[model samples]
Target: MWIIFGILTLIMTLLNLYMYNAGKNYHIFMVLSLFLMALTLCDQYQMIASWSLAGDWSAIADVAPTLSMILWIFVIGSFVVNVIPLLLSYRKNR
Candidate 1:
């Protein structure tokens, strides 16, 4: 199930990147895809950690908490970047 989520997230990210490169208006989608990917990474990390601590390495779990944390940081940064422009434009119009 988690693997499926990861794969979907990866696909979304790639699609967003392609759209971005193609000069399409998909900044919001890019940000959202990144956020989802970050969440999936965090979930995968937790699953891996639990399995490792229980000494159950054969369960085929994915880990890497540090990487997940980094991704979360990126997500937050990207969210801010995505929102600030909209806020500025709104304020300017008002």
Candidate 2:
């Protein structure tokens, strides 16, 4: 679930970038990016909760934190990549 959401988020982010470049209305993509990001976070938390319930201490300890960190980085990096170009274009237009 988390992996699926993560991949969707990446694809949406790329679509956002493409929309920006094409001078299309990318606001819907922006909204979808944020929505997908939230879904991904929820999926990650659910995964951690399942591991905790199953008493998988090793996975909880060894994987969860690091995976969360990587997820955050990927989300932020993709978001910035999508938004910065739009910002630049706005300033360029002005």
**TM-score (all chains, Cα) for each model:** 0.46, 0.86
- What TM-score does candidate 1 reach? 0.46
lDDT of 1 by residue, 16-43 (tens): 5566556576566656666676676677
Off by over 4 Å in 2: none
lDDT of 2 by residue, 1-94 (tens): 8788878888888888888889888878877877888898888888889999999999899997789789879778877877786788889999
Looking at candidate 1, the ten consecutive residues that score lowest on lDDT are: 59-68
Q: Considering every candidate listed, which one attains the maximal TM-score?
A: 2
Look at candidate 2 and give me any clashing residue pairs.
none
Q: Provide the global lDDT of candidate 2 against the true structure.
A: 0.83
